[model samples]
Target chain A: MIILNQSKLNPSNIQPSEITSREVFENRRHFLKAAGFGLAAGSALLLSKQSQAAIAPVTFKANSRQKISGFSKTAYGAGEKLTQYEDVTTYNNYYEFGTGKSDPAIQATLFKPRPWTISIEGQVKKAKTISIEDLLKLAPLEERIYRMRCVEAWSMVIPWVGLPLASLVKWAEPTGNAKYIEFISESDPQSMPGVRSPILDWPYTEGLRMDEATNPLTLLAVGLYGEYLPNQNGAPVRLVTPWKYGFKGGKAIVKIRFVEKMPLTTWYKAGPSEYGFYANVNPNVDHPRWTQSSEKPIGAGLFGGRIKTKMFNGYSEQVAHMYTGMDLNRNF
Target chain B: MKKQHIVFVKAAIWLFALLPLARLIWLGVNDNLGANPIEFIEHSTGTWALVFLLITLGMTPIRLLTGQVWQIQLRRVLGLFMFFYACLHIITYVWLDFVFMWDELLIDVAKHPRILVGFAAFLLAIPLAATSNSYMIKRLKTNWKKLHQAVYLIAILAVVHFWMLVKKDLTEPIYYAVVLIVLLGIRVYFKYKPLSKSKVIKAM
Candidate 1:
């Protein structure tokens, strides 16, 4: 039979100095009942004192040297409730694992993200392949709570821990001719089962204009809610372009290439009429089959009500200038 | 059939027909509908609607092939259940999703072809559901058959709505489409073929 962790049940009484034997720990309640004390009192003793500690909200811990700096938590962070880490981790659209929203969480558990390497190549002056361990050391990670908007008209406020993508770009030293940056996700069918389906071209690809790639708001997230990124959320590393639709932030990234021309993104290649290359979160530009005027936050209760969608997902101040004269409807 | 047996069958039909809605309520009350409960509710109701529609359409073919007149008794129940689920699907969209905001809903219905098609299918189901009783069936006679035949068109529209709603996987809608085609094909074959004595007796 499986045993509940005793430490979790009695947080205060259990300590390193007094190591309880496994047999004693497992049979403590039986021993207590055998003794003169009433079972109710014995259970009360165990349950009362540490009840608060037992139910204390879990705080996620970051990796060593992964603590970020210079990120001031904004009003948006305070205004919007953070999506539960459980919900954020479990409900994902990582088609690499499978098409179902819950598929990634179950299927990606066996995925080995450690001993991973990401290649920075193409139009960069100094193209190099770096280990994930070394990649973590490249920049100080920061916690930025940003609104993630899906093209499917759902939204989530996520606390992401990562450094700016511009920092990585600077390290790569991109050539002036580099107009766009293409991101390639890990797509070996042996590792990612969803790749077996021809629903999308395998080895999912996404791209951003050089300026968008180098924008201050663009992040290369390795963690969420102050913890190491969950495998379903693209553990080790993933892209986070807050102003764009969530798909633009390709997960389980294995390659970042600086290109002279705009590369064909996977969604654009799959259905150009539905998914555009720019993919900026604009309320006015509806998807072919659905309206983008409003969104249902994932954890929001049934009929929890929708909030109106904003242009650039309410990051107009930061990203609107990038498309000063361009028509959002046309680009969308 | 014995009167008691018919009553027992009718009760069983009611219980079976109400199971999906009951399960939905249980899930809703227990908070077991997962993260996006609204989506779970919408998808469940919509899918059940399609299932009941398929079952209702299959009743005639099953009765004709098996010479089971009792199968016809369950048709009205299944047809009503389809309409009920379709109503729930629309209510969830209008009340929960759009919050009765007519302006936004109008714009949404105008812009999205899938929504328009789905709404059209639901609209078509309403008259059939209202006229399902013996009174209307007898009152309209042959015209009732003509009106109820709109179900074939509604089935196609429902399938198209499903096809348009999905993002990548076409497996589900394709499966539904195949079932609908086979059901329609059976009807077409029986309609066109010269009836043998055995065939006419079987259909009767």
Candidate 2:
């Protein structure tokens, strides 16, 4: 216990200058913006350190990404601390951009997530292409603060702004034969470097059972932190299943299909033995390579302690009933 | 090579070997270790350990292929450096990553094959690191050669441990595996091949 309690010691206090500061993640983007501002606003801003004041501490880069105007905050994970916007945006696993955690932020800079239309096919009644505009209009956007646990034993709290996936399913008008919903991400080799590599089969696919797809807890997130999705974070539109691992949500989705049989997901096909179709965040069921019993909180700084992962990522009340009588360990 | 040149080369290797540790400290000081500092440290130290171990294994191959005896003399220091980083990696995993939770650490070593394999590599390294001194090397005699050969197993375990840890995109680990295979392949080819008198004399 003596050594175990070492986590309680504040590393920052030992060496304030050397320790990882939360301000680093927060101020990194500001410094990038300041550098750009110094160039764009002319050499006057670069006169001295004080000249950085020309760029405010919080200058939202006027990129084309739109902001969601009227998203109402929800009680879901409201008490939890949101991961830093920089960390959430920069540290990602969208393999379409690349394999590295920071690859998407750098590599997806030129990726055009707009002009996107999700194609609905298979057993849907109204099988048609719906633009990003109509997708948002399906329902009022809600700012749902959800805990997303990655299978790699890391987790983040994100304030995702989007409509319930149930609304989109209702809009799709799936036929009675629809048993599972498969989400497909767009794969353009010219923009996405990872698509060129044979990492996972391109056009990354993920699926959810019929009940899970239409659950109120599930979301078709288009924006996060009040802004339209960053290109790296599956911009324009993507799926968000809080109860499952992050990879369960297909990023930058371009198609949704209503199918009878279970849809083969990218992860499921990649490692059939390790990744199961239903990748619910079950702490009891450990991943083949790593443990799921505990997860490191992203943006918790250097001396951060591990947090015990909750069942179904703490959305068990809303999601557990769906898995009733179904063995998640086997399904997982 | 001249005696003074060998000394200079060993000093240079020492400087170069210490850089990765210095870089970790620099990153810690600058807060550049990213969102998860534990992961960054673990990977940096673990990767450096593998890099040093591979280089140590390459020293004997250098002597075998080119008859450069000077290079093999640096193996002891290089092996010691590998042990240093491996120790750091294990400490980070047990203390910082698991917070010295004995049950979790035991479970990690006992349950997960990746952790178990990695732990085995570290345990095997201890005996070799202990015998990396002149006193033990002199006392152990012919047995020293036999005992230190455990590095071959340790190297394979290190690569296998890395191969299993990755979730997807096995590109990085595959490179290390390929290098290890080639290094071992050379020894096997030299050992079993029908030896020409002149070639054998040159290799010796």
Candidate 3:
């Protein structure tokens, strides 16, 4: 009884990669990438060794950099290369100043971010106005170096210095009816040129589900790179959600409201289909204009390759549970 | 124009065309290309390519309206410069930005209408570039004129390519699109105006 076709491996169909065990094949690719990076990093390590100093503060303006003391460090994103201090300060998306990447750095120089007060109102037990100083004292500052993936297919690894939004949430003590948290960014027509135009019905607003607001990864970042946040990089205070796209992290926030309904956000208003409430960094859900599959690392220099983007910007361990049983594609 | 004056104008155009690239190189050396040098390079090159396409398109319209044969003489040079900048732009995307990632590029083009149209514009420009020479022009004859018509499509594709990539702000792409419309509009008006009058004469 000769079998017409035996279950033998067809030599023609077998690829060189298929011949190796899955583990070995995967490891080989990893080893090659690591080898290349090792050679590239050799010079960087040598140069860094000579300094042995803290990474110098780089500001677009002369007096912009101010050190923020007493913030404890964390191992989060410790392995990732920090986007250059200059890039973090200069290249920003604070459309308040202007739409150009460098516009915020240049235009926000004289714009004031001090004497700020965040009004926590809506469905909270009691509405309270917390000043910048008072807000700083609520929780001890900590350094969380999270990978900030922008909605525009770009990313930066920022060492954000701030307290978690959970701290703010706990302080707010929302009512049972409070299902969502809304963030309102400053809309100073006098200072912010962008708000003057009918750009997204200004006084930019962002929102998150009550659960998302209290996530451990959700940060109320006040500073970055060991310095008080640069005016262009959301001075005084801003939201930094590692799992979500950068736009979800509103800048120069002035008000936070506890609402039963989801608040209309600036980006979602600007482009409904492109931007959504759950703007979680899901590589599977593609933004209509830009590909979400991979992102260009800002400080990776000119010839750097775009690294494949991860689910929840690689904070799945901490934040994936929050998005369980949800359709990211539709919500995105 | 005097031979010397014509030569001087050509040289001046050459200097002007090279300025953007020279400035980029200087900026790159000085580490002044800003935070995202790759983005800076990509955008700068793309802008220059669109600018040149308009400049090239403007030549025929200038010749038509002003009846200046000199602009016609300069047309080939301008067209070649447009193609040259376009080549540099695509090189930056393929080499520096995308890094020969064909699989990803294929998937990207499939997903994005902008990428596919932009690539189509670049592909169409290749034949125009190859046949711009005197030898090809002599061989193709009237076919040369037909082949060159793709420039109109290329210009449109290039504008759409730039237009679609913009997130919310379309102020820049609008300028390019408007210029293209005017340039193409003038050609349409000039081509049909005389024919309509001739038809009226026949009716009379």
Candidate 4:
């Protein structure tokens, strides 16, 4: 189980982890009804390591980090290495934590991310639910510089470390009829404070078309900035798409389903006219009451001049071909 | 001599009113507003607009309660200044958030209910501003009072705009809401009290 050290120390250098398999954590729920069950369960492992005075560090070496061939860092710390809890957990996109830019940072600290698994099903030929560890072992982790464009016209550049969804889906073996892939976030209201908010439907959900999911641009991120994922940024698993609006990247993910038809998405379902399934960051397509032609980099202040938006967040060379001969204005 | 003195005083008040906005523009240019500039600009303009609005709403009450006729003359000026700040608030969102994309801008306003409420408040103020001149007031006559009644609705919406954006920090918005309710309460109490037109004009 993945337990967090609330202190500022690096997970790898922190005290020894009270490691427990998913099987025991999930099955022993009834046993945890007793008093002091948490300390009692973890103390058994803690006593075994007598030499470790403080605690052995929790090491999260998911996979080797490979650099993608051609991508530029964003203006706001895109390619910069993220310090474990400081960078990854501090910056967040959860609006329910409070709409303030720092709401997610303050509220997401309570998230319990251990003992999570992702269920992969739908139109896949070989469908099975895999623990986060199994999914991490499926593909090699690679560092890809992704420019995240929010629907609100603010942008961020993040170097995400994860496997391409195409490689992982290949393992699941998507059926020939599968036309779309939908990702569901873990809906535990007990830990995720945002789930209790009325602003967005609980247990946030997002989806991408089969082609978009398989596109080289899509990544199932396990970490960013050379460390394990932060709780604010989806922790153990989440989706990362370079060409689309940031909302397409579902956070705190737990389920991945392949379907023959387009799946209903949270933003689209909440307000279809405002948020479309194809929320690609196209400067040409304007939001109903705002222009999408430009964006202010996050932390640039509200009145800062906008940086001109690109055709596909400057990823036209890699993704523009998908909309060949079709007018982006119409699709947008 | 008194007329000349009045002109000078009016000019000075106009300059003083413009100063706060000038400082905001300068701060925006220098990027000194702090992290999350959008929030800073939005809050600054929204608060200034509310201040000017409350001041406009207070003109009659201030004049009646304190017998200051000069306060009535400042009403139009304050109302316009409120409109000015509202314009800045809208402009900041258009330039910074929407990047001047009319379609997306329209869609965003449509999608976000809070923005729609704010837009309604701003739009209602526009007609009141346009009809503020003596020529329109004299032309409309009885309709002038009806036309300006929109300000009450605008005031309520302005409060709603403040309330929605403040996710958790209710202190600032709630304070404004209470002040608005009190101001509206005074208007309501006086509204039912029987009075003569000359006495009302003298009080204002």
* Alpha carbon deviation, residue A193, candidate 2 (Å): 1.0
lDDT of 1 at B91: 96
Inter-residue clash pairs, candidate 2 = none
Kindly provide the TM-score of model 2 when superposed on the true structure, using C-alpha atoms: 0.87
Of 3 and 4, the candidate ranking higher by TM-score: 3
Best model per DockQ = 1
TM-score per candidate, in order?
Answer: 0.86, 0.87, 0.86, 0.64
Off by over 4 Å in 1: A1-78, B197-204
lDDT of 2 by residue, B1-204 (tens): 899998999999999999999999999998788878899899999999999999999987787777768788899999999999999999899878888777666766887998899999999999999988999999999999999999999999999999998877899999999999999998887787777843864756
Summarize candidate 1's per-residue lDDT along A82-149 as a digit string, tens digits.
77555687789998888888899888866767668999999998798987766766665566789999
| TM value for model 3 | 0.86
Which one is best on lDDT? 2
What shift in Å separates residue A269 of candidate 2 from its native position after superposition? 1.1
- lDDT minimum window of 10 residues, candidate 2 chain A: A47-56
Q: Clash number for every model?
A: 1, 0, 0, 24
lDDT per residue (tens digit) for residues B1-204 in model 4: 266776787798799888888988798787555445675777788899998899889878775566666657778888999999999889888887666778656766876567899999998998899999999999999999999989999999999888876534466889889989988887787676677844675654
Per-residue lDDT value at B197 in model 3: 61
Q: Model 2 lDDT vs. the true structure?
A: 0.83
lDDT of 2 by residue, A1-332 (tens): 01111332665434342233455434544554554654345334322323212222232332344434345566777677777666788799988888889889889977886677889999988899998877777777677889999999999988898889999889889989999999999899998898998889888999999999999999999888766788888887889999999999898889999999999999999999789999999999988787889889998777776888899999999999998999888999
Clashing pairs in 3: none
Q: Is candidate 2 or candidate 4 better by TM-score?
A: 2
How should the candidates be ordered by DockQ, best one leading?
A: 1, 3, 2, 4
